[model samples]
Target: RALNVILVLQCERRRFLRVGLAVPLLGTVAELREMVAREGHIPPEQVMGGMGGTGKGRDPLRATEVPSAVPQVILAEVSPQGFLRSLGDSEELGAAGEGAPLYAFQPPPARRPGTANPSPLAGNRGLHSLDWLGGQGLPASPGAAQPEAQHPLPSAARSSDCLHRGASSRVLLLLCNTVSDGHRLTRFGPPLVLREERGISWEQLQQSILGQLRALLRAEARAQGMGVPLFRIRLAEGMEPCTYLSPQDPHPLCHPAIDRALQLSGSGGPPHVRLMAEWDLNTKERLFGSVQGEAVEDAESVGLQQQAHRQQPSCTLDECFQLYTKEEQVRGTAG
Candidate 1:
């Protein structure tokens, strides 16, 4: 009978261990942020924004606009058992009888040769643990349903813990382009015009661009068998325009924003490639005219060489060899 009781208790402990192991789904907000920053090659400061609210507000018209700080990411700890129990009324644990065995089993009489025996009832020492277990098999308490009605249980739990922890469970980031007071109109366009420059809407533009970029990134990742999610893009509120027109000769025709964007993209790869494409689009005129000019020059040189070869009349062997030597010297000098 005692051996049977011990076996039953061990089985119960094993069941609880399994449940505990499976209870939590863990992830850190910091880890996610770091991953995004590294993959995007974005500076941490750009993503987090400035330290204080010193900059102009996201809204252009607000009188006392405060610079927005990065929003925090939230992590929720969900209790599956608690959630299930909240679905309906739950039964309570039975009351303990006076002088009754607090636990159901006793330790074995002998210890094994190389192993130590665990104290019986050690598992039941904590009153809370015992209470939890005692009520485990019973129906959930009536109060369980109250939480389900108030709000989304997961969100509520995350918020409550987030507040108590003094950290936001939800994450937000910001990216901005610096603009000077002087260049605002020339580089960025007229402030009034920009403010009124409505068409597809900023939100729609952001969504469209982000969607396309994410799709491309996903396809590439899939091809490479990578598991990481693609980086996400969000528009920072309040765009400030800056002009980059030549200081010597300001052309109303020159676009500063496109120039600044091109400068940021640097010399190689996708950003440079994209910049050239955008430059061509913005310029409308043949921006590759210089390249065409270089090609034309090369063609003229080739034509001159071919014409000279054809025009040359037959000559004596000594004269021919002397002419070849003279041509080689001229070529070396040109080269």
Candidate 2:
């Protein structure tokens, strides 16, 4: 199933360009941002707005008032009551519900000193066919032009978790394998995006990890006649030795140990992908032990395992279990 997304592209001086998109019902906010960037001709790398659009009190009209070295594009949700809410890239689009309106705010091209400001709405040169919506717009800044919009804003405003304020933590997960050659580490897929707002507990995190592993093998299992995947997380923070996660401890995300590690990592950025997840020995024997051994025979012969200590081990998806961390199940409509 798919839904139509009505996106209003907002620029300074009352210029509005509206575009429509047919997106999968299950498409994510990150995917929607990319689609908007592609359709609206936004520079992907320059599209570095925070999770929620510019918060209240910031003037969209003033975005272009100051000279900026680089341009930025921001995506935000407009409520029925005409309030703006920030959207997370990893969130599901359908969470916004039916007939929900979206707005993309981009500043116009930078102007050199002493150049006359061009009228963005004159003759509707930059405005596309508009689905004009009326409500009290953001309070107009002094001397800001008022919009000529006529459509009435929807009466009922629906609440969605997607509009909440929080940043998702992305953690990189790696698998550890020990052979006669020694320790070999490899990353399977993209970094896991933790969306829990209240802080994640150890048990919840473990289930999420195992669930992702099962999803990766489910397709192959059905075709090749295999069993469910099995593995346990053995977490090790940045540059530290590995240790198994225990059920005894809860609220791992809030642990002081993790906080100290994040402080001392010295990267001053998102923590490194140092968390290790060990595959159960019995699982290797039952699932892909022989297949991996055969697939990497040449690498083994060439001492690749020794090199894997420094880099990712060479292997194919078919030769190893892959993990894909995805969003939680969402049920709603998008329009």
Candidate 3:
């Protein structure tokens, strides 16, 4: 069976590597960790070192006691709600669920009290500490206070530069409400502007979109007195022709299509972008019914509603926010 694993780095939790491996169902989690280490080109020692646990209930000074070998990389099952349930080393891969998503998190180093944490940029200190002007024969005085070093860039300017860099990394995603009428595809409502910054993995993006849909779906289902249906989000490149972002694609976030779209937006192209979303069959059916209701009514006369069925296509992203707020209010009042 093919196993999908998300490798989380200890230093940078936001950026992760998503990898697929072909392994036997009977294989153990220990074996799985080894495979992940090999696939990612990470050291096996780092994946499963002698040290383990959450650094609790262990004696540090006990020389006579032997430390049991524990996997340094934590293997856990991520729930739809974003909670993690760690898997045991001896646990069978099949028990975790066939083709289920798994996360391999590299644990940060344990820190004890009274010990200082080292800076991540310590290696770069050599560049700053070196005195290039020492050969100029400037005599150093003993027991004299040194002058305060001046920085090339002021602190405020540096901070602003960082801020601008972050802003530049933001991707404006126009989330178009997409659905099918059993024959033809139709997209209604104003596309929502989803601002995604850099350093987020494709899996993280999928989860975020799914979480938003869950809340909206629940609120709508409650408002309509119907069952909440299961759904999935299929990301697409543009509005027309539906160039799908395949789940099998290793780098969906950094795809060439997305790059082209971003480039177009950066230029003097259309201010608005429309990205299509593919829904499951059940969600499509539910949405089609809602669309029928919208066709028969005047959207402006209806005012703000808990179930805004995308009747007003000309509405802006602000109106979409209002719709979500209205739904939240309905859900709150109902509860």
**Top-scoring candidate (TM-score):** 3
Task: Please give the CA lDDT of all the candidate structures.
Answer: 0.21, 0.37, 0.41
Model 2: worst 10 consecutive residues (lDDT sum) = 127-136
lDDT accuracy of residue 310 in candidate 2? 48
Q: Write the per-residue lDDT of candidate 3 for residues 1-33, one digit (tens) a residue.
A: 556676655332123566556667688776886
lDDT string for model 2 (1-335, tens) is: 23333333333223335555556678776666666667666653323333323532346555422222122344544332221234555667787434345555442233324654333223212111111211111111244222112112222122122222211232222223322213543333222222222134333454444333332333333233211213334434433444444333333443344444444422211232224444544454443343331011121212432343447558777555554444488888987
TM accuracy, model 2: 0.29
lDDT of 1 at 334: 50
TM-score of each: 0.13, 0.29, 0.30
Which residue pairs collide, candidate 2?
30-89, 52-86, 134-151
* Most accurate candidate by lDDT: 3
Q: Counting only residues 3 or more apart in sequence or on different chains, how many pairs clash (N, Cα, C under 3 Å) in candidate 1?
A: 14
Candidate 3 has its poorest 10 consecutive residues by lDDT at: 127-136
Q: How many residue pairs clash (N, CA or C atoms closer than 3 angstroms) in each of the candidate models, in the order given?
A: 14, 3, 0
